[model samples]
Target: MFRPLELFIGLRYTRAKRRNHFISFISLVSMAGIALGVMALIVVISVMNGFDNELRTRILGMVSHATIAGVGESVRDWPEVIKKAEANPRVLGAAPYTEREAMLQGQRVAGALVRGILPEQEPKVSEVGKKMVAGELHDLVAGGFGIVLGKELAYKLGVDVGEKIVVYAPEIRATPVGAVPRLKSFTVVGIFEIGMEEFDSGLAIVHLADAQRLYQTDGPDGVRLKLDDMFKALGVARELAGDLGGLYRVRDWMQGHQNFFRAIAMEKRVMFMILSLIVAVAAFNLVSTLVMLVTDKQADIAILRTLGATPGSIMGVFMVQGVFVGVIGILIGVVSGVIMALNLEAVVKWIEHTFGVAFLSPDVYYISDLPSDMHWSDVGLIALLGFVFSLLATIYPAWRAARTEPAAALRYE
Candidate 1:
């Protein structure tokens, strides 16, 4: 089959050697700019996506996707509530929990959130059990007064499993020495590392019975739930609340951490917009390159027009030329970017080792290593944006070339 006249000529112009080497160089520069911009955008967005995913796993995994509690601050019928929650297809698991703000005193004092959990059921609702660095979850028996410290918290307090620590509640109690803060002593039974500094530094786990005793409650504060689809947490919670009646209140993960994730999403958008400017600038280079090519080929264009080429066909030639530059750049960028993203963690480690530097510190960040997660959807969007920008850049110059007076161009030539 014969190719279209415009496309045939366009592809030729793209591959043909230019009389002005500077024009060829400009085309290469434009292509490089597009490739670099696309590569940067892909790598950065993938890293951001990776961070988002890691946070979800390391932080949210330790927390309940949703919680069901009575309006009175404690769920006396938590077993029934757990049954009700598990009845829902969306609910994966549910476990009773009691949480309170307290101070842990050991070698040093640190503010802590003490969570009361049932050893047998806690693993079903949260990942802390799986993340334990020392001891088993079943060791936390009712009335055992056993406590589990986060790895960082254990480090901070200079305590370990089988060791003892004191938890000071804010509640005041009548002591022999008048009114004083309520305090309890317990032996540490486990140390868990969830890979999140905030959780590992400020959170502790204890037996459900011990927590209830600490809080002076007969039952758990709530039933924490795990869901098959985390994004469906809010909807499922609302449905459960309706099914269970107003006496029960439901809360989902987004309620507590929406702002943090929202900030990350906004930053991603801002970065995209900023980096896209580089692609736009590179696309503009195509306009300049095509314009100079038109100047150099004015007589040739006149000859083509005299040979019965239409204005639209002339425009098509240049548009095709610009698209060639874009397609090549985008293809190269996509391949390189994907490879970089897939190996980013290893690459970052190598850089740190070679340069003798730490890019991310555990104390300063939630995670100590760089991460990357490449989504083909994001790659497709970047490629589309680059192609559109390059296509648009060709419009003005192509239009100018199409409108050239054949006689006048030939006379000048």
Candidate 2:
């Protein structure tokens, strides 16, 4: 409905000087508000994405993508299970492991989940071999009864490499006097730091044979598998379960830590909703600005109506002006937001260095550095929403302007 005449007049009105300077001030404020809201949304979302990615990487580095375990206490044919798992093209690596909760006594006593792994094959499924700080995975020998401790667990037990610690298994041994917990002494052979407190504070590693011997199990508890793509863990696990039949159980990495990731996703959605309100308020400001502009231009509107301009054309004039303002604000916001998100990490580091203050101290937080990962899709979504809000704000005021009576408007003028 908008002709070149409406377009020319709308552009002229937007650029033309007005007697009411307050209208200009309100328009500027609206633009600034939209820009600020969009920028904040982009930066916050990017940081959240970065944290999600960082945590996922660290956690997955220590855990397998999927696992297949026996229906009973141990998988007697674990090597066969590994072989079958490796036969799948999606499965990249597999290793057998046994796990049990035990108490370690040294200078002090601490509880931990002790895991048994084949040192030769461990590197294929997990990164513990690469994360050791004090010793190597090879130090955990089957007959020697050597153990690897997490850095925090070692500190809690007041033990180090070469020190001996007593391990008490949950299984009981019958004695002449009474039944007692099965116990063994294992020399600390290695220390590893995964950076996550859950692992670093409560995990111990030993040879698969040693764990089986200590727990009195005939074989390893399960087989862990690493896939070519971590995201496909669930599908691969399901296929393995079907192939292995009802005799085994299969689980994916996501099943073990669903709550943590779900909470993060919920928080992100809430943040987006809260931030969108800011842009909505700014866009609504356009309503008041257009109403005032329509009143100010009544005489001009009357002249155009008397000259036979249609009401639809009159409405289009104001709509074009409002849309132009919205587009400008969104463009400014998108450009500024993208730039800030890309440099947020560097900016945070600079501030910390200059002020001698740590926002995330290494002593207190596992992830000490500020991280930002910008996604262009988020920027585009924000811009689109801002424009839609701005466009909706112009409707009522434009309709009011279109309904003006030429005779009354001219008489007033």
Candidate 3:
């Protein structure tokens, strides 16, 4: 197959050494700009995606995806509710829980939500036991008024496992004193760190019996559920509520952390839009480069037109050239992004070590280190957008090249 002479010349012109040093430098700058923009977008977006994923695992893993509860009071015979909920294929595990808000006093008084959990079943529903940094899970079930505190809470109160902590909740005394804050003491049995400041600072866990007794309730407040896909929690909760004939109310994870997750999603979308402009600016460089090339090759354009080249073919040649520029830059960017994303933790560590700085601090940030999650879809999108921009950049220059006057060029020569 013979290729068009105009196309051959177009490619040749792209490769030819220009007499103007400024033109060559501008062309190189355009290519470099595209590469840097693409690479930065990929790396930043991947890190954002990584943080989103880490939040899901670190936060959702410790809490129930959904909860099945009665209309008013604590749930009695939660075993039956668990059985009914588990009957659905979506349910992974369910466990009864009793919880209350009270002040924990041990030289210092701080507000705390003491969750009552069954040692054997808690692990099935939450990552609480798995995240235990100190002490043992089984020790809490030994009926010694054992309790588990979060790392931050332990630090704040200056207490650890085996230390005694008093919990105060409103108690109902019918005799002389009316309803008053009930006071109960528990021995700290475990300390856990889930990398969540909110939980680590204000959450504690104890035996279900202890919690119910502490709350003066005969049964658990509700049943917490883990699902195969936690993101499906809201939909499943709605379905379960309907199945229960409205006798039971359902609450999902979205309700618990609505503001936080919503903010994150909104930020991601905004960042995508903002970062895409880097690609747009870089693409504009292509427009300038193509226009300059067209101006320098005016005689060649006239010759191609005299040789019977159609305007569409003229456009195709330059468009292909612009696309080539974008393709090379995008390929380099994507490869670099993947390499950096995969090793982001190490890279951050190395930078911090060299600069004597910290990227994330447990007290300041929820996590203690940098995280990165490379997404191929994001890479595909970046390359696609770059191609589109390149094509757009070729338009004005291509139109000018296609409209060159063949007769006028030969007359001037």
Candidate 4:
């Protein structure tokens, strides 16, 4: 159907002067629409990808890849568990931690999740030590009962470094007066900000020994593990659990935060579907353009049929013309989208500086910078979608052109 003769005529018709300027204008509009739609899809999808990556990195910086905990109140043999976890080649580091919910009182009172860590071993599985802004993690001595607070939590409690706060543990003790909550006074030695509300606004850290004494625990509650490949955390956790012989409960980071990540993924998919409508609308415009062109070129089609051109060849000519328009638009959109996505951050900064407007304010948003992460697979899929839509739009008009009768078409002429 797409022989040299048909190809030549199809290419010629695309460039030929049209008697009806409306038909030419409609064709141009269809091409522009496709280009704009494709560009928008690429940019939007890239931005979403960037946000997902950034959030994951920030959250994982505080959360370990996997954890192993005893079924009881505390893991009494935490050191042995760490040694066993270290034997796995995939496990890069391991650390034991104790966690509890507590209320802290300074000038103001607020609830927080209190965690205890060994200053030396904590760095093995998490980045809290490096994230400290005011003091060092090593400042918490065993007997000193020093504490580190999240930046937001510290602000809410109206305290800073060198100040003191009283922590009320959930555990209660019997006294002559009545049952009272176990409580202690801890000196605020440091502050850290993780840029996440979940941690920054409700987390506190203390020395492991101090935590054990205060909480009346035999040892750390669990051992945290860091894997070489975080994405393989589930498999690694499962293998570790199996090796431990059901004596302990093992969980991966995703299990703790699956709902949050799932929401982000669902939003991305919804945005993709919503943006695809723009491309679909643009591709459907091809139907109108080709239909008009077929009506305007009735004489030409009739002449071609009379000259022994097969109906299939006639259909091929119109299909080729429509595809050419789609291809050009897709190519332009792909090139423009790639260039824009690669420099999105710089472009956003420039706009903000020049316009004196902040798209994302640091006070309002944890991540104030515009980020873009383009995936080639997304680009390829969008291009294919455009091409398929364009091709489908050509069928009806091309079929109508192929069926034109020579005698009837030339009767008016």
TM-score list, all predictions: 0.96, 0.95, 0.95, 0.96
Q: Which candidate comes out best when scored by lDDT?
A: 4
Encode model 2's per-residue lDDT on 1-413: one tens digit a residue: 44588788988888988899999898888888888888888899899899988888889888899999888779998888999999999999999999899999999999999999999999999999888999999988888899999999999999999999999998889999999999999999999998899899999999999999999999999999999999999999999998898679999999999999999899989999999999999888999999999999999999999999999989989998888888888888888989999999889999999999999999999899888888889888988999999999999999999999999999956
How badly does each model clash, as a count of residue pairs? 0, 0, 6, 0
Ordered list by lDDT, greatest first: 4, 2, 1, 3
Model 1 has how many clashing residue pairs?
0
The residue-level lDDT of candidate 3 at 97 comes to 90
Candidate 1 lDDT over 1-413, as tens digits, reads 54898898998988788889999999999999999888888999999999989998886778899988778777888888888889999998899988899999998889999999888888788888788899987889988899989999999999989999999987988878899888889999999888887898999989988888887888888999999999999999999998898678899998988998899899999999999999899888999999998998899889999999999999998899988998898888888888999999999999989999889976777689898999999999999999999999999989989998899998856
Residue 284 in model 4: shift from native, Å?
Answer: 0.8
Give the clashing pairs for model 3. Answer: 169-181, 169-182, 170-181, 170-182, 171-180, 171-182
Candidate 4 lDDT by residue in tens digits, 1-413: 54588778989999999889998898899999899989999999999999999898889888999999989779988888999999999999999999999999999999999999999998899898888999999999899999999999999999999999999999889999999999999999999988889999999999999999999989998999999999999999999999999999999999999999999999999998998889889888999999989998999999999999999999999999999998888888888889899999999999999999999999999889988999999999989998998998889999999999999999999
Residue 18, candidate 3: Cα error in Å is 2.8
The true-versus-predicted C-alpha distance at residue 184 of model 3, in Å, is: 0.7
| C-alpha lDDT of all candidate models, in order | 0.90, 0.92, 0.83, 0.93
Question: Residue 328 in model 2: shift from native, Å?
Answer: 1.5
Which 10 residues in a row give candidate 3 its minimum summed lDDT?
170-179
